[model samples]
Each structure stands twice: as structure tokens, then as C-alpha cells.
Target: MNRPSLTWKLYIGAFYLFLFAPLLVVAVFAFNASPFPSPPWRGFTLEWFTGSGSIAGKPGVLVDPIWLESIGNSFRVAIPVALLAVLLGTVNAWVLERAEFRGKTFVAMMMLWPLVIPGVVLGISILAFFSRVANGLEDWLQTDLDFLRPGLPLVVLGQLSFILTIATLIIAARLRKFDRSLEEAAFDLGASRARVLRTVTLPFLKPALIGAGLVALLMSFENFNTTLMLVGSVAPLPITMYGQMREGASPAINAVSLLLMLGVGGIASVFALTSKAER
Candidate 1:
């Protein structure tokens, strides 16, 4: 292998710095003793992550009710979104990659349309469509549908709109490379279609499914634009953090950012390891 030139090495270093500098700053600030997440560091302290509100009235991320509730809501939305997206995405992937049908290309394009649309537009579209449905139902059925209102369900649906496309793409990429002979061999051994799917196909797709699910989880957890439009009285972590920043940032926000970084990094690491193991 040819060695990289000095200039190329410097370029790579600069690229990495640009990518990670902000993250490094956030992580460093998370440990800062100061109330604000800025320069002129007061000193090193775990106050942001573990301090009591009594200590200068600055509550830690773990102890703060707002942060806890928002984090919980983010998880509440993300788990369902990831599960539903992965389940539906797997079916879509199978249909797109395995089954032959008329207008297959068109169907695939339509399924992926959510990804091309801006997040704000997708959120607003879902909001409007559902609100209209809710209003019509109220007039027709003489009752309200709370689920149709702006809430966790809507937030989950909004995130899933684009996330489903991502999950489909991930699973489809893996499914495309799957060997059909394995399924044929199982059939030759008199395994039923369901059994083949259960024992062989699902196992083969496990890594991809896991990857898609984790990516979906991360995306759902961090999602803001779509969630912002559909969120109910309770906000997700991103929306909560945005609110805090707008009012005034605290070092606790940096702590939350660091935790998010760790979470996202852990998911990426798992995906990498799973892919490597599968290979």
C-alpha cells in the first residue's frame, strides 16, 4: 500500500478535527464547574451531572425533573418508533428486494419519498392530515380521538415517516446480497416456508435488523423538527434542550449533550461490531 503524503495526512487530521472539535468542547464543558457552558472554565467538577439544586440552585441533569421527563419521553417515542419502523421496514425490504411485482420501481420510489421531503414539510403534512381526520371524526362520530391530536403518537408517526425509509434502505441493502440457495436448500429438506423464514431468513437478516433498529432509535431520539410540530404538552429531549438554549444555556445541557454523544457512539460501535461479525 502506498503511504499517505504529509499533505494528505494533514488534510485527514484537519477533517477529523472539524468533525470532532465541537463534540470535544461539549464533553469538556460538561465537567466544567461553571453554570454556563462556555470558555473561562471555572474548574473541574461533577456538579452538572450530579449536583443538587441546593448547590447554587443548579440542578444536575439526572436530578432535574424537566430533563428526566424529557429524556423519558424521548425514549418513550423512540422505542415504539424503532420497533414499528424495523418491523415494517423488514416487510418493505422483502417486498422490494425479493418479490417481483408490477410498478416495483414506482413503489420503491414512493416508499422512499419521505426521505427526500424536508423534515418540517413531512411533520406539517402529517399534522394537517391527521388534524383534518380528527376534526372530521369529531363531527361524524360525535367524539374526539385524543390519539389523533398532537402528542406522542403523532410524534412517533412523524419520526417514523422518514425513519422507516432509512430502516428499509438498511435492511434492503443487506437483503439484496443474500443468497437464495440457502432457502432453496431448506426447501429441499422439506422445511415449510414459514419455518425457512423463521429459522434461516430471520437469522440471516438479524445483523441488518439490529443495525436498522438502532439507527432508527438514535434518529428518533435526536429528532427535533418533526417532533417539534407534533409534540404534545410534553417535549422530547431535543425540544427541551432547544427551549433551554433559547431561554439560557446551562452546563447541564452540556452534560446532556455528552450523554447523547456517548449513547449515539455506543450504538454506532454496536452496529460496527455486528457488521464485522456478520462479515
Candidate 2:
């Protein structure tokens, strides 16, 4: 094959630059000694990541309670959201792929509605619907439905609205490629349906399950629109960072961005390795 032309090389270079140049800038600024995440690079320092209150007169991202709490909140929402989304998505995939049910096409299309809806719209809809339900229940029964309020539970549900669809798609794609003969053979060998599913089907779907869970985790962690609408007193990392940015840009924000990059990169790496091993 002929070598790539200069124009092709230039296009590829530009594409990657567009994709990663901003991230590179953020990574660089995370180490900047200056207060702001901008140039006139002051000498490098670890203040953004590790400064003590007394030494730098400002706490670092690791030591700051706001950042720490926000980070904790993010994991709190993301872990459960990932687990539930994957579990439900797996069930949905199995039913859609295996069960010959009426209105199956309609059900599949309806499940995809969440994926097509804008995040802002999904967030607003969940918030409004839950708020109304909470009000109605309180009026009728004089009971408080605290879970329906704009808090971590609402935030988890909001993220799940769309994330579940994504997980379903991922798992269903794998399920579609599965050979029914494997299940048939197992059944002929006297294995129970549950045993066949647990041993053969689940083993085959492991990669897809893991991939969907990791993707869901990352999406929930980075989600801002739905979280913003549904979050109560406790904010996730993305929400906290947004508030910080609105006040003023700071190197500390850069530090957080860098950490996020590392985290997302790590997850992606794990997925890649898992996929490779499966292959």
C-alpha cells in the first residue's frame, strides 16, 4: 500500500489535536504554581494537589473538604447507578433477545426514547414529575416522600433514565450474536435453564456486562445536566467543579480535571484489556 499523503497526515494530526489539545493544556496547568490555570507559567509546584493550609495558605484538592465531599458524593451516586443499570439492562437484553412477546418492537423503541431525549429535558422531566408526586402524596396522605426530593436518589434515577438504555444497547448487541445452539446443547445435557444461564450465558455476556458497567460509571461521574437539576444539598464532582468555575478559574480546578482524566483513562484501559483478553 502507498504511504498516506501529506494532506491525509495533516488531517489526522488536526483531528487528534482537536481532540486532545485542551486536555494537554489542562494537564499542564494542573502543575502550574500560579493561582490561575493560565500562562505565564509560574514555577511548578504541588500546591494544587497537596498544599497544606498553613504552608500555602490554601488547601489542596486532596485536603479540601468540599472537593473531598463532592468526590465522595459522585462515587455514591455512580456505583449504585452502575450496578442497577447493568442489572436491569441485562434483564432487558435477555427478554428482548430471547422472549417472543407481543409489542416487542414497540418496547425496544420505547426503551430508546431516553437515549434520544436531551439530558436537560430528561433532568427537567424527572424533577417535575417527582416533585408533583411528592406534593400529591403529602396532600393525600400527609406523608413525606423524601426519596422523591432532589437528592442523591433522584440524581441516581435521573442518570439511570439514559444510562440504562446505553447499557441495554451494549448488552443486546452482544446477546444478538449469541448462538442458541449452546443453550440447546446444555438443555439436552439435562442442565436446568437457570444453570445454563448462570454458567454459559453469563460467562459469554461478561465482557459486555463489564463494559456497560464501566461506561455507566464514567457517564454518571461526569454527568452535569441531570445532576444539576436533581441534586439536593450534596453536589457531585462535576457540579462542584461547575460552581468553582463560575466563581473563577483556578489551578485547583485543573487538578481535578487531571485526576478525572486519569480516572476515565484508567477505566478505558481496563475495558480495553478486558476486551482483548476476551478475544
**Candidate 2 lDDT by residue in tens digits, 1-279:** 499999999999999999999989999999888877889988899898988856556789999998999999999999999999899999999888988989999998999889778899999999999999999999999888999999999999999999999999999999998999998999999999999999999999999999999999999999998889999998999999999999998888999899999999999999999778766
Task: State the local distance difference test value for candidate 1.
Answer: 0.92
lDDT of 1 at 246: 94
Please report how far candidate 1 places residue 49 from its true position, in Å.
0.8
Q: Estimate, for each residue in 135-178, the C-alpha lDDT of model 1 and write its tens digit.
A: 99999999989999999999999999999999999999999888
Distance (Å) between predicted and true CA of 189, model 1? 1.2
In angstroms, give how far residue 40 of model 1 lies from its true place.
1.8
Clashing pairs in 2: none
> How many clashes (backbone N, Cα, C below 3 Å) per candidate?
0, 0
TM-score of 1: 0.95
RMSD (Cα, Å) of model 2: 1.6
